[model samples]
Target chain A: MKTYSIVLLLCLLTPYLGNAQENFIFKKAYDLKVLGRVSEDTSHFQRIDSADLQNLPPAVQRYAKFSAGMNVVFKTDSKSIKIHWKLKKMNTLWNMPSVAVNGIDLYGWNGQEWQYISSGRPNSEDNQMIMVENLDGKMRNYRIFLPIYAEVKDLEIGVLEKTTLSPPDTALVPSSKIAIYGSSITQGIAASRPGMAYPSILSRRLDFDFINLGFSGSGKMELPIADLLAKIPAQLYILDCVPNTLPEQVKDRAYPLITRLRMLKPEIPIIMVESVKREISNWNSAMYTRVNGQNDEYRKTFDKLVAEGYQNIYYISTSELMGDDHEATVDGTHLTDLGFMRISKTIERYIKDSIAPLQ
Target chain B: MKTYSIVLLLCLLTPYLGNAQENFIFKKAYDLKVLGRVSEDTSHFQRIDSADLQNLPPAVQRYAKFSAGMNVVFKTDSKSIKIHWKLKKMNTLWNMPSVAVNGIDLYGWNGQEWQYISSGRPNSEDNQMIMVENLDGKMRNYRIFLPIYAEVKDLEIGVLEKTTLSPPDTALVPSSKIAIYGSSITQGIAASRPGMAYPSILSRRLDFDFINLGFSGSGKMELPIADLLAKIPAQLYILDCVPNTLPEQVKDRAYPLITRLRMLKPEIPIIMVESVKREISNWNSAMYTRVNGQNDEYRKTFDKLVAEGYQNIYYISTSELMGDDHEATVDGTHLTDLGFMRISKTIERYIKDSIAPLQ
Candidate 1:
């Protein structure tokens, strides 16, 4: 009778004892190998230089602070993963879910490809949540993508007791980057999650680091942004800013930006993208005229640049970006996960076929 | 000089005059030809019978009021579309965007196919917004899908003052319905917008009314739900409730539900679907076991039914639903637009090849 009672007592206390033994070893994100950054900002996860904030426009500065394409890559042999993160501020978007705007997307490398495990769903400015658990506890490579539209104030990764968590022995992605500069779409405005963004998807598919320099409402090929792009040393540069630039702005700004970027990086490949066709323009005549006008002006600029004997320069039209079904966007403008995937596949084809580094 | 002054004054008053002349005629949703309904509840936009609500579980009753897959189809010559809507209550989900949970999706049929125009982004319980403006003044077919997760209190459509807003000259979709009963996924839990739900996508592609009988957490193949489903006069019935039912529950309940449904509707075709393979299960052993166990029990029940000489019955496995990549879901469970599109395409292929009515 005493043996049975003792056994029952031990069973009742097993869960609590196991929980007590879960000694979590937390690692600051600053100590990890971060990807998709061109500037060394003071903030741990920002995309651009902290010093450039004062010189740039307010919107650009604010958007640059978001860790749109930043991710931390590490190796761990833990059965569980947990995160305690604090956002710079609590932000909400009408068309974007909080999971995309303020969440952590974790993926595990399964030999050949990265597979999604879970997302850290945020509840407030500061949140602590278990991302995934009950793993087989093999030493494996893992990448955790940061929030696409919000800034992280602080981040710490937690693993089970006595588990090994260290920097990866080999570089998973190449050091050479494909830097993309564009509008809100490039900034991943309406992706279902951060990892579904076009740049992140392309990085996973192409096995290269793709830097995101997308500035929401500010990717107008302004000289300030162009100068910033010229400073980043990348193997390839893709300019996809026609959607955010007016026709007159395109004619005025496209030539100087491309020319300066060419002078700065003499032999690097550069691809120019036209404004994507908007489904709303199918019915609204005014929007049709405006978007088509922007594209025409952008095309003229590209023709002039080609005539000037620019080498290793290319242009991509809108015809091949989003599919013909017109169901890829949440609003008439912002691309959803479907749109992001479609666009990324198109870009991936270009990178694989034309760019020597990726090939 | 006096004539010039009058011309300038007229030009200054043009916007106000146009605004005053832009009279809108409003129509209640009850006056339109609505689709994807099995019951004639007093509410203009509910899926189930109001009387049956008292007898069902609270979760099922609450979910029944949500007008998932319900849409209004009409023809109009108005150059713009506007809406004034009220919700039963303001609700929010961690994984779903507000635009999907509470917004309205509008699609206009061109000569060949339906094209997405814009989404009515909701602000509060009582909301008014212009869905689309500056459309070409042509008599066109339009369909407006309602919120997927929120119940509607009242809805009204507005068009140009003199333009006709009448029922479609011919039925755009067939009269026969394909009733799909399942969990929150069938209710379009994490879709980016209302029209991206699998049922909505299938309706557009197949041109048939695909009814949504999904209860969020209550799709346990209960006898009451089975009886309710049996009463609906559908040409085909798809049982997709395995995700919400445990192995034991499925073993105890699936046979009775199928047998009862078959006994009532002898000729109607039935399709039983295995639970979808969740990406979370790839790394988590507990989830892997649970989901796989549910599918195994469901398959056994299906095999039993087929062996018992059940004619016009079929089964669908989970292998071909979401793509090999694990990026289809916002969470590891509820699908995003990408996942919804993929799953809908898979189902569409099955229907086209197997279902006689659709073919």
Candidate 2:
């Protein structure tokens, strides 16, 4: 009977093991948490308020204002893990809140119930670190319940699987970042959801980091803002502020902005983008005129840069990017989700073929 | 003295004729007129309320509340122009009003003062046309205004000068249009201004008619939407809905959606976009796992389509698109305007090299 039981257990484990092998082993899982606090004190929660859930999707809406303290679950399969978290405190005027994690809530669950483990707030600057020997081999799920005062703007949950057991010495290093300075369209005004934004979409596709400085109507390529941009560390800098500016502004700002960014990070790739064609009557006659003027200015800048021996700068024409399709835009000025995808793919290829080679 | 005066007049005329050769012509202009009615009648104005303007940059905030009796002006020169105009009525609903030339505030300087020639609505669909003669010869600034019930969203003005005039029939035609579909990032959410969006930037560079269809969070690859897409005529269709869908959803819908669109337009180009990398703790481990699974399924579908002898289907990998920059995202998920510009430029090159050949 014992032998038969052992064989049966092995038989059952075969499928599970096969699935484990087939599962693409992502980076070793880590205990990732985010903590924040409201800038000020607030009343206790009684029940999940519908109004609080307004912005969330239906799946997570009901849990918006949990009164009895809700348990947040995260799944992972690693014996050791690292935690990266952020703690923010909001003020009265600014509703943004910070979340916190207590030592009691960090627990290791044996199959039946969650077993309390150790926890503490991480150093503010060194928010990420590794853990060892705390996890069991069983599918581990990390759960945390908040004090109902904090709001989580961004959170990440990952598991450390052991196909690769050793963690890198420098784990959780910041990913390479691409920075775009542009107008309203970059701000994600019309996209259906936050995650669906093209930048978000591109991030997922390319496995990199991004910074969106898309001020809705504020991408004027002014010197002040360009000064701010010069402070950032980026692998690529994209300058596309011509749509909102008049031709004179385009002529005035385009070259200087490009030159400024290049001056700051001489080797970093700089791409100057012109505006897309708007859906207006007499599509060809009028649209091309403005486009050409902008491009001419850009070209002149590019030529100057080239003459000055700058080699890393590039220019992307609008016609090829938009492909003369009128339906891609929701309004004449903004792109629909479809338009973003098309442009993202085109960008993806360019980065791979052109930029990636340099990297 | 009389002979000297005649010579002076002739000399002035000679310079005027020479100046005509160097002016920029306003090839075609489209005037978008808004008729004001009671705030209750929202149908007349494509109403965009204050809330809609909430996300827009300061420049466009005033124009967010588009009510009836608001006149919006859009114009194009031989190079670039504004194509689409969306407005909000006083009641807080967004509306798209028909644009006409007659309603434009046309003014001509009668030697002493700038007099209003006409302020009546023009028949846009019928006899809607504005032609400027000898505009390039003299440096003249033309302004178009749209008065919204609340405030103005955008005002576009173009300068026309005298130049070699090409007959209207000789005007250049838009070679093709690239239709992009995706999410909020594609829609230019959170960007400082409208024109800064990557699509707009890319459009300005390439000089193609751009149709932006980026809904905030609604790019789910649903058949109902696909049905609507099938009706439109386009040279290229870029499918970028992955950011808005889960891996299972992508597997289930991607192939079908591509196939459906292909069925409608057999020869049109269709490009499938993968999602961008998210700055999750695991660096897109889980999302990538899901994306790869979906991509595999999509590739298989593409193979099947090819086997069935379908052409013009392409895939753009995300890795090549974003380069090594991961910090370009504002959050881990969404991109800053800087990121959009980089992505747009990258895509612009890809489309130019790949699709331009076919075109």
Candidate 3:
């Protein structure tokens, strides 16, 4: 009689329990854990967020919010995953918001390397919902890449009950990292999804962490942006801003930005890259002049740095960036997903050599 | 005074010329020359078009119109290229209609292989426009891949005025060639655009014309479609239907289709493929069972064929499909553009050797 009475009371309260669960969906949402940047106690989860948006110049301020080549790492064992997020208003003349997976993609580690899991995009507007069901319910490391050409207004990850979640292993997600700064190619102009971008590809293959300071057409190595990057501590600094700069501009700005970074983080390893030659440029005369000039100026800057007795600074030439067959780009300037894969494979050895051994 | 008057009259007629050009956009447009298929004079551009759409089972007919791997090759000296097209309404769960470039991408030969020039997806609805400007003025060979997951109601290509256009060379567009039939992977589920699809990639790399008979989920080696395919003459037959079949279904359907094709065209090379394994399947036991079971049955079919004294039948094992690191997919099953590249690389050697050397 006692057991029957208890069962009757539980059935009577089922509707109230369902209502509680519904309310909790939005009211008690968990913020997705983001690493590879400064602490969030300052209320900053992305590289460029509310605090610094106002400080940027109007020209680059728009790109600053794009969340280009940003990443977040953690570990989770969720049976299913849901992302409640909004796409940023950011867009380019050549790229659309939807083609970039609304600027987010996720991958999970399979005890060895990262494997793609899913991405977030919904056809509906205002409130987009992306739900991934039937995940392998095992303890796996997870990584989420932010949009390359768009910003995330807000994003939260929902997991099933009692799924064990933790931070990434320190070996892979190093406390300090190699920081990369460059133009649209480095910002992942045409990668299919955010994580497939060259920087993210390098991070996955080499097992390291990085901050991509790629700013689409505007990554001209301005001193103001360099000032913000200098504030962060990293083991190596990679400068890839030659593509967006003219020879005259690189002569004026590239060395100064490198100088500023070196002063702030002296004795750190620095790797600078010449602009990747566009495949079409081989035939287009005007393009050939521009590409060849960019390489000449970038090499000049490297020579100047060496002459000044700069130690542990390195350079990667233009020929090494693309294959001899030249099947590495979507447009003449921007990289496709295959371009990113080829570039990461081409430059991995040079990139790895520049890294100082972990203590 | 006469010379001045003539120049003034010429300037006055410029708007009229512009209006004439506008009228010619669709009215005087040239039907894009399609290669790699049997003649459509029998009113069949694909395996089955409007002529026989009524005859196919409702389920298979729904997928037949998607134009899974159809390609058109042409040469033009036009300074600019334009495409006017409408999207076929075939779509998948996660991939949107607009996400797949709505089934079209174009590339130009750069003396060796295909270089991605551009892909088309106009934001506006109905009568989308894709205009590629400032192309090299010299005669350039071009290849346009039709939709992988969608079919077109009608399509036309427009080049700049006074440019020469011609059909592909006979050497490149061979008289007889390979024909491939398979599932959605064979139908290109997640390539960034149609040209990157494996069949198209193989077609370009091997320099051989092919008829791509990949239907989305209906590649169960049904006798009806096989009957239609058997009528077409090809140098080789490639069967990649393992992904869309259960072991029991394979045991029942695969052999009959092969036997039928053999009876129709003897002494042709037939290459069978095992389903490409997914990275997530390593831990998902149910998925592992499905993938492994499919492979076992496929191998069994190959062994049985050899035992029956069938010569020139080849089998491609699954281990070659993905790298040991297993980072070759977009989701657990669908390939990203990189995955497609890795796959095209993995199987190119086998597929190439099967091709009789180009005369």
Candidate 4:
């Protein structure tokens, strides 16, 4: 009789043991908040069709389009979770299908093979909110792969049946977060694969997050974008819109752009990026002068920022970005993947030792 | 009789003006030497085709494919002429056609517009020596822009038209050279234009000569490539090949790569680069292990080198490069142009402060 009891006990505990061994579980859900309004013009927003959210990886599963002011409630049974986000104003440029929220493909390993979960797309209506759910519960440690610009008001968590709530992990590991604001390059255009870009490589090296606000050719350091950037947080902000801007425009906008960012995030590091040199030597007769002039203006702004008790502002010389040996660049404008990596490494080191510690 | 007398007076006076503006012409031709060969097979050595030489910028007119051997020669009538060059190798899977240099194209600035002179596809069997001649005597300060690899052993100038050589009113300034070696990102893949690549931008900022030997997916720190790199004189040698190599591979190669470069050029500054993190989760899996292993190996190597009296080596963590945010990357690997600019600035400052002085 005792032997029979023992067997039954073992049988009863087998299911529990299996559940424990399956470590992957959802933890908690949060209410994703958006402070903006949906544009009345539906054409200005992106409408996501019914797709398989399960196809996306956990990192990007929560990215879904919704109307503005709509609450995205994420539910999980896990305890504490980390959050990251970004936001941008809706404009005509943002309405294009190609300009929708990109770089949100997520993947996870299912022991033997990697599986996809979900992806993010622009909302169909401007000023609408895109929300994600089941993020914290889906993975133990969560990472939102896309650059989200909405306001993150609060997070909610709950302990599972066999789990307990724990404090968030905040270890001082060597990490970095670079915020890139520019045009198509910032949007990962023309790369053979998404991961082959320099920024992606840099992120892999640094063990940090990235906020890419590249809006195709539409990204400029305009007031609307800068205002949006002011709300989110980052360790460094890289401004690289000169390529899309005319020289006169750069000259007119460079100083104001730096000043705006400095005013918002006084202590964060800001690296002003210049446009790459053109392959066509004489494409723009005033390119040299305009670039030089904009550079000088940036310098002046940096100096001014430094003078105004903002110590982390710096200017990255445009020449060092490409053509150092003149072989890394493709047409004197865009870089090959190798060129991007070379340039990213150079900047990665500077930010790690020189900029991040200040934060 | 009066016209002949006037012409004689003009001719006599012309000599005085020509002599006044005479520039010093070094007698010996510039000696451009090929250091050594780097190829999987020596039987198919890469050589510069003379026909292709006509396609280079007016400044870099030469016939010489860089091949293994120290016997290559470069002759110039002026001691300081702009050097331009092009080299070809097999393109990789991840390489984009926009960034590949399969043939040579010539560009010239015609005061008001830039003109395409010629383009040539190199025939493997051609034994033509590249040549650069001053077709127009009006080219006062010959500026040579080398788009490819052709080493300069020495430089010389010679008198033309029997005129005595004197220093020209303006002198050619030799920009500090920055050499970078890495994978596809370093090769400037996906960049919309060549100048948009970070390395090129950095060059423009620093006014430095750039040598971009970024091989797409080929920067595995192989000994042959390193051997090639060792022969080139540079202010800085950036090793950013981690993204192209698996973490395990990086672990195996990082130390040896650094050690070999140090062995070849003891005094040159070698910046060791760490791989960037992927936006995808599963941070504790093979990717993390590989990256961390490589990074640890690099650190250990750096420490060992420093312990062994190598003080010039530096480390740039990937974290600092990408910042803590996750949006900078386009598709978990490559960077948007904005990301490229950020990285370019970071490295530019480091080069300016750390390596520029040495150069």
- After best superposition, candidate 2 residue A296: deviation in angstroms? 26
Query: Tens digit of lDDT per residue, candidate 3, span A223-341?
Result: 87667776657777788888767667788887898888788778788888888886545544444565577679888888999999887888998878876654555444566666777
- Tens digits of lDDT, candidate 3, B272-316: 888888554564444466557667888888888899988778888
What is the Cα-based lDDT of residue B197 in candidate 3?
A: 71
| DockQ values, each candidate | 0.43, 0.02, 0.20, 0.03
* Top TM-score model: 1
Candidate 2 chain B, run of 10 with poorest lDDT: B93-102
Docking quality category of candidate 4 according to DockQ thresholds: incorrect
Ranking of all candidate structures by their DockQ, best first: 1, 3, 4, 2
Please say which candidate is ahead in DockQ: 1 or 3.
1
Error of 1 at B18 (Å): 12
By TM-score rank, best first, the candidates go 1, 3, 4, 2
TM-score of each: 0.93, 0.38, 0.83, 0.40
Clashes in predicted model 3: 1
List candidate 3 stretches off by more than 4 Å: A1-33, A42-44, A53-55, A76-100, A120-140, A168-172, A357-359, B1-32, B42-47, B82-100, B120-137, B356-359
Query: For candidate 4, lDDT tens digit of each residue in B120-201?
Result: 2222222121212223434332222222222222323334443433332221223355677765466554233334445555
**Residue pairs with backbone overlap in model 1:** none
State in Å the error of residue A329, model 3.
2.9
lDDT of 4 by residue, A1-359 (tens): 56643432332111111113223323322222111112212222111112322332232222223111111222233422222222343222111111222222332323332232223333322211111222344433222233222222222333344554432223312234556666555444433333434554455445454555554444545655565556545677878766655445565676677777778887777776665554432222323343355456555656666777766666677667764444343334445454666667667766676564775
